[model samples]
Target chain A: MKQTQALNLQQKTIKALGVNTSDAKVSLSYLSVAFLTLLIGGILGLVQGLERAGLMELPPWINYYQVLTAHGILLLLVFSTTFTIGYQYANLSHALGGLLPKVRKFAWTGFILMVIGVVLAVTMVVLNEASVLYTFYPPLAAHPVFYIGLVFVVLGIFACCIGVFINYRHWRKNHPGQTTPLLAFFAMGVFVLWFFASIGVTVEVLTLIPWSMGIVETTNVMVGRTLFWWFGHSLVNIWYLVATSAWYVIVPKIIGGRHFNEKLIRLVVILLVILNIPGGFHHQIIDPGISESIKFLHVFMSLSIAVPSLMTAFAMFAVLERAGRRKGGKGLLGWIGKLPWGDVRFLAPMIAMIAFIPGGAGGIVNTSNQMNQVIHNTLWVVGHFHVTVGMSVVMTFFGICYWLIPYLAKRKLTPQMNRLGVIQTIIWTVGMILMAGSQHLAGLLGDPRRTSYTTYGDHPTALSWVPYEYVMGIGATLLLLGVIIQVYAVINMMFFAPKGKTAFPVSEPEDGAPSAPMWTERWGLWVVLLLMVVAMAYVVPIVDMIVNAPPGSPPIRTW
Target chain B: MKQFLYGLVLYLFLLLPPVAALLESIMIIHMHMQMPLLILSGFLMARLIQLKFPDFFRKWNSNGVPGIMLFSIILVYWMIPRTMDEALTIEASELFKFISLPFLAGVPLRDSWKKISSAGKNSVFIIFIILFSLMGWLYIAADEQICNNYLRVDQITLGWGYVTMAVCMAIYVIQLIFGDHSEYK
Candidate 1:
């Protein structure tokens, strides 16, 4: 008899969540696209480094603005975004106890739309017709194709989103009256948030796509910025929220031998779902027409998102304290010392949470209206965002991939990239710091983001920044070096890593419904909803200013 | 469908590094191209070579340490006299300006990461990333990188921007070297 009989579809939903894990045909395809995009983005970044320092010169086709515009759009919009949504489609739905109906058909459509969108966008950008910094901020505009490309990409995501929603909802309906699993809820929240987030940007793109192509006359810049931020701020936070969801469960399961305080975990989820929405206004701090009071409100809500983080941190620490005590750990922070030092899963989260400290620091500064001006539009802002967004969220994605490839693809990431999670975590953390720091300093000195050339005319008083740009370039080299190694490691894993095929049986929930604490079931839903309303109260007025600002008041100049 | 997505990403990836070089080559064909493209090509080549083969390439990735030890005699005796007069009172080049100034890998002494633990790991870099940004807050409090800053700070600045990124990243890498959050050990 076979070692294990293949379970019916229902059981496979939970235990065999990986849709195509065992099949080399499926896994390799996804990995190829993912790796290619990542590598391309990495090279573009290094090119930017060279440009900033005026190390090499080239054609208008490869100009700083052109490269940056392409790099910015491709990396965030096409690369990371695709991997994120795609991974969720292939893996998370089953992981969340849902079945993907018509999976093959769905994948075909999603993949097609995405490719078409990316190709069209790249073509337009390379043509020198549309070099708008990835933002839809106007009177600056791109060729109509850029907007059309974006529409297709968004449509693809919506396809994935619809599939995910249907599956999750079905899982809940069949399971009935059981509160939604935390991961499931988060996946759903991400879907809803993304759907909502796309709204403002979608409208802006629709309005501007025509004008950029000369299909229409002038459109309002203030309105455009406001709408884009409505999408932008929330968009980044959605990444934060999604990444953190895995953290809460992954960390405890790593250290606790059993899971941690359920009520606390539930509270964090509810807090995140609510706290994330209102903070988008922070992106508009210095923009004219946004009310001062409204900006303050967004900042407050942004900070409020920190509550769940703090709560999770404390609870996570408590779990660590228990584990440490069990192992006889005793010292200032000896508990951390005693945990499994070699286990990649446990170690990855430790590195992630530790990095979260800096990620959090940048978050606070970014939302501050007055402080934003000091660092706004400089490398500092870029550094702040990349670290928070890059290290915190992206690292989570990396960590999960490290853990998942083995479980899903049945292969280990090896020559044993000894303590893979721990080592990469530390390297990435360092890279984020060095890169963000130099960028911050460069930005503070008035070096603009997305500029390919910094050694331009009559800015002699800023001679000091020239060296700083090189300093930053060196930092980027180090970061890119780490990334290159990581790419190699990921590739090695696909072909060479150890494989594990023994599957766990489909079982009851981690904690039965009754055992799941009471306050968790009761308060989480209400608190998140209430917080969402309060946050919107702040975001609404700021948006109103953008919506209402008369045609062209003229953006205030630094001089 | 999958092939299309695959082609676009791969093409773009392979296309970027060559962009500068390709742009430069355009001049050979057209007889006039931007000066920035020429300079950019050099940087791109260095970057591409470095990434493609960190340990293999001889001209670029030559072990600065061993290569230096072996070539020192030739460099000191022959090149010193030939270039000594020009080394001083030199002006920075406009296009290759980054070359004229000092490059700070901070002595390139090697071993930023201990044999036992790498300081350049993603994890430790993150913790330092936090402190590095807070450095600005600290500077604001002291009324310098601290004082007239905070919400009261004025202008979009390079000092805070680049320096904060540098300090944050530097501390993370350095901490990996100095601290023993050595997951492997």
Candidate 2:
């Protein structure tokens, strides 16, 4: 027992002194894959944008849909998933004093599985055998290999989820009666949501596999769409939750202020976890095979998410104001001026949070049944995601990279790199505003999304949209440049930055603040409540879709 | 008192004509959502009642088994398809539903839950899981509409609801079995 205690003390000292080389290797590998995918996806995004604006034409072999599919899958699925795993695993290791050996094995296994899956899926897209787009909605079926690849991806996610869960349980067992570190808690929320969310899409993909293989003659289109959105919408919230983790934990430390009330933060995380999956119905507000009354009920359910979001917004402002006041700033808004605006770590996520104001408001507009009718399949919907995912989520991720990459690589964050990151953030922000803004305007003017550029025989209305399309092309060009700079900064930080130690920034709670309540630790209870809410939201409509399903659609390769 | 007031507000809101009609418009909402919410309201209100009539509960439910048995009976009676049909069509049956679910099942549940042993609580969960799975099978497999007011599809939906709830309870039970709460506590 004495030897075990001594060994544990030694281990803790080692962890506190520097990054564990093994754990750093795991995270750095994932980050490497994430940035590489970003580079490829960024190029594809520019190509698609330029093509849509009629500034460039694709060759005969590579169609617009093919490029679109590859871009969405690479950036949305591969890049984001890899980065999240990398970051969350690093958090787990830091907070829990390093992952169990088995958990690290799980991480590496997940990485291999995901890489294999991406290769298979991307090969299908590149060969033009699968151009169903990232949503992969039927009857536009992909190659059976594509669906098989997705299954592997889901399995990979499950591996990571299991790893996180095991590490959490081990920590809880050892600590006993203590609340988990805040970052670990957020990691748990992300993985739990990821696990449940993937279930719906996994089911969808499995059925699609058989159908695409001609083992099944046809598939239920409505059910397929419903299941896809069930996963798709929750995936957005998962990214949002990850961003908020950084906002709540890292940003406060960077700004030299304490985090907000622990209870309120935990409450927000809990509420988000319970309420997020049901909001998927709002994505289907305009889809058929659902009753008007049900859709109306779902509007309320979706809007329920706004409660926690408002709470977050309020908490963030309070923290900022309190921090600014401590710096001896006077007057009503002078406190804002006291903030470190020049710090890319603060600026990127700060702008991301600001973008959420419009992003969230636009979300409300989309959730409303009547409002959704006006912009359902338009470029406005595209614009909305660009603001939310691109600015709010991805920007936060970029900010994280500046510190996280250097910390893992045991390197100094050079001032030059910091300046470049700020520049990249500015360029990315301006590019997104220009691109997403024009998309919104064009959509309001009835410009459709997911369509190749067409003149409709040079109709006046079609010709009028050309200006907005050109702005989008220019914005895309700038965004690609921003991506290049970001990738370069990340590479330099990882390999070429001067060797040194960097601290992981996790903010303390306010002095004399009340401790988080024990009830928040009851994860089993929370899971049950989440399941009950999901059952309440999904059972009726899913049953209706299956029982009253239309004649199933056969697989079609539109591309 | 605050809990009682909130509960009263919930109970009154549930009693509102439009709210009642809207919830009952769908079969699963009527049986699963509305009924469970009524029980929750009563659960919330039970604190005030327990304070007021401490001896009344103590005398009859000292061992908790009596109160829990009453709760189980009330829940099982309501789970019957005929009871739901009658509650929809018959005035007295509907009134009984509004009275019995909250006052009978919900109140007793709150009173007994803490008093019961871990084994007793697990038994309750086990019983419910078994009962719900059986009901789910019956509802999903039935050739004819079991309830007059609800469609066959609605019945199947309700079956799935039962199955899902049962699954949730099963999970809770499994966690309880595996989770060493003593370590955390």
Which tens-of-lDDT digit does each residue in A496-535 have in candidate 1? 7776552311123345534454334332233335433433
lDDT for A505 (candidate 1)? 16
Which pairs clash in the backbone of model 2? Answer: none
Quote each prediction's TM-score.
0.67, 0.98
Highest TM-score: give the candidate number: 2
How accurate locally is residue B164 in candidate 2, as Cα lDDT from 0 to 100? Answer: 96
**Candidate 1, lDDT over the whole model:** 0.57
- Total clashing pairs for each candidate: 77, 0
Per-residue error (Å), model 1, residue B62: 90
lDDT of 2 by residue, A444-544 (tens): 89899998988789999999999999999999999999999999999999999999989999999999999888778777877898899889888989999
